[model samples]
Target: MKFPQYFSLLIVSSLLFACSNESDSDTEKSGIPAVITPVPLDTYFPPITRTDEWETVSIETLGWNENQVDNLYTYLEDNDTDAFIILKDGRIVIEKYFGDFTKDDNHAWNSAGKNLTSMLTGIAQQEEFLSITDATSQYLGEGWSSLTIDQELSITIKNQLTMTTGLDYNVEDAFCTDPECLIYLNDIGTTWYYHNAPYTLLDDVIANATNTDFNSYFSEKIKEPIGMQGLFIKVGYNNVFFSTARSMARFGLLNLNQGTWDDTPILLDTAYFNSMTNSSQDLNLSYGYLYWLNGKSSYRVPGSEVEFTGSLIPNAPADLYAGLGKNDQKLYMVPSLDLVIVRMGSASSEIQLGPSGFDNELWGLINEIIQ
Candidate 1:
């Protein structure tokens, strides 16, 4: 779900028009054009609700006094961190960025948007939009429904959420297209591949079930309630959304609070929180329902051996969950630390969505100060 750096501006322009035909005139009625205003890097720190909650600690306090966070800033500046913010104990702890990124700049969350969509699924199911147990074909109509007679019969919403749909991730046309496009590579529940097309179709499932567009539904149910002025961008996919790094942090903090937003039960199905944070697929123990898990020590790499290492913190509480995107756009929530750390920027690495060793390294550094 991560867009290339070249598309950042393109996405912003599209964001303004995302709801143009989608029945979201209220956004314009409120006088907020979908237009994105660029913000300077240094001024991107969002106003904290309560600054006293932030306990600033040096890298040394986190066991890396010699490891300057300023060095990290220098690296980000040389690279591209449009916007980044970190929260510890519900307060801003570290906020920094580079280039034109700012507090108000609405950067694309890419696949990280999937994590939000996954939560929306829980909400939809809670509202009885459709049960997770329903077969994918149930909502997808004839084209996708035909798969039942064939090998695709096993596919289900659960499989889609867990990414165990068993469809070949290699097919370009089918990979991106719906129903007619996807051919079962293996059987359902057999493989783990980052298949985008099937995941995108889940948007339609959600949309059809509720008789609403994904973006509007999400805003009314999740974003608006949490006070996050988020705009879900409609890219080539069916249900992609865009939000400021601050808005993204708001969602992560909601998860950090286990589905409660300011004492309100925005997500009625709070039981799904733990399941969303834990691995749902047997193939990749590090991934959950669109969210990445930090509790695992091994990662499967394509064309390479499985890499193994300890997690960020020894005996770290297993409740830490995250939404990760390309170029290192991250929303990390750790219930144990009562912390939500957000980093949005173009890192030096081109493939930012893989098993980013950076997560462990950065968390290790942050934990030094937390403990």
Candidate 2:
């Protein structure tokens, strides 16, 4: 769960680009036609204070044998599952739950929310909130300007999304107070480190450009259109969402379709989807726009012949990208298989602390059913 915290006003500024095909326009290659009228900034929803209304799905005919489904449920029940859902070829293949979780339960996306954060950056570019090429200096201004000129020159929205900010990779700096201590140390796009602070800084960029809180902007722009009843929780100084497994699956489904939700084009451009799922950083070739990719480039458990090394679950598809959270929350998308798998739970033991052998195990079972 991300808490919305205070941000330094020291940043850069840029004028909103018209979503045009001009040389300066960021929307040209994206092919999502430019908007005639920019979306109003005032439409943003306030921090969630009302009761969350859930979208209901009646599940009676997914066709899995009750025993088989029960076996999966039993497995999760024994392991602390809050919810799990599987979508095959855009259809709900299975949905199961245990341990105080329900269809309406709102669980924090934790780091799982990072992908959504990245996706929103693309969406913001599509809507002309800010261009992808706009330097970080444009939004983060004089406060950031105090840094060495070369450091200021290297910062961009792309670096933030790709986790290539050239910042230090120290876990102790997870929630650093002084942004200056974290200076740009390498080429902007050349390095990759799993830094949450830079990623979280995006909320300020989006909010500053759009003139609203990140939660409301995301709710209006992303969740509502897809019929996802999710909320970006803002407690004290952090902002994150609490969503049900089904809704998380839907978010993955949106990615599986390359940023389209149903017939509506929420992302405005699918090109952003391509670059997002594919590698965006050189160091960690296993990560995309705030989303983690499984298979070849990733580190796997020792002596696991499952050979999941870089293989996205064939049952789940090799192109699968996931939003992984602390304590075992996952929203996985497989493009070729047209599948989305969501799991939300607390870890029963320290087992989830490493490359979960469970992912390989779960795929082993799901493959049998798919075959």
Candidate 3:
């Protein structure tokens, strides 16, 4: 299916004109043009407080078209979105609670919670708790999978993070964490498949490596320091997290700063952070270590073998990346724009997993408003 191209021409024109018309004075004052000067990162590090409120940026100050912004919210509400928020320079630029949802309503992160697990796993490695290079069986024990000891040993922690574990997704219960459900499909790193069983197993890896409960480890290491409130509750075989929309935004802001919360370094392993947000393997350029990356030449979605051409979300900025969840729960970060966005609620459509057509449509609306 092709994405809508209604705003394609206008978007291209706006970007090109902005790039080609930098004045000499602008260049002299700063190496970059004034219009494109990055918002200082230090200016908006949210105070690490236990309160439910966050600082916000006025829409007028953002110079956003008010009519378009209203229309954006209307469109979101029409599509079953329970909550939507847009953050500019770490301040809430647009915050809306739809239906019966309020700012304090807790919502499930679904698969988007994987992004948090990925970050915490990096911290675990940094603290000498575990190593990505280590085999998955090393921590989970040798019989965690149905594969032979040798075949399972070949699957490393890195494979799990990159979705290159070569685990079979054709089983009766793909989400099942039982050893019998984790059948080997190919040699490690030979293919990339968005299998949930392997990804969910990362929790066990972290738990075993750190000798602490997953949620407690997360609280002490990440949530407490950043003033984020949430818990990874077990749902069947999956450990999904639930939090308020603002807490989701906080995590996005943390990622926007590359794992740092304000001046404090929540994840001091810079190398892991870089690898975690970029393409993690040669198989899928659009996938990092559990996060979804945009601006890649091609991408592969869950349950599909066909490769789609172009960036994952064409209407979003080229530098955009996201932690997308089932039912359209989204946490997007655009470093170039100094922006972070969150959306939570029921499924916008029948699509499951990450990078759905609704993403393109929603971003198209966002482009109309922000431009």
Scored by lDDT, the top model is 3
* Each model's lDDT: 0.68, 0.67, 0.88
**Candidate numbers, best lDDT first, in rank order:** 3, 1, 2
Distance from true location, Cα of 315 in model 1, Å: 12
- TM match of model 2 to true structure: 0.74
**In angstroms, how far off is 362's CA in candidate 2?**
2.6
Better of 2 and 3 by TM-score: 3
lDDT of 3 by residue, 154-242 (tens): 99999999999888899999899999899888889989889998999999999999998988899999998988898888899888999
In model 3, which runs have C-alpha deviations exceeding 4 angstroms?
Answer: 1-42
lDDT of 2: 0.67
Mind giving the per-residue lDDT tens digits that candidate 2 earns over 304-364?
3122345533334566678877666778777665567888888645644223546665666
Measured against the true structure, the TM-scores of the candidates, in listed sequence, are 0.76, 0.74, 0.88
Model 2 bad stretches (over 4 Å): 1-67, 235-238, 297-316, 351-355
Scored by lDDT, model 1 comes in at: 0.68
Candidate 1 lDDT, 1-371, residue by residue in tens: 98898799888778767867455667657777765433212211223341222234433333334445666566556556677676654555567766766777777787678888899999898888888778887787656733546555567888888877877766665336655567757778877777777888888889899999878898788877766776776666444567777778778878876787756786777667678778776677777888777667654532233444655334335667777766667787877766677777665465655446566556655554455
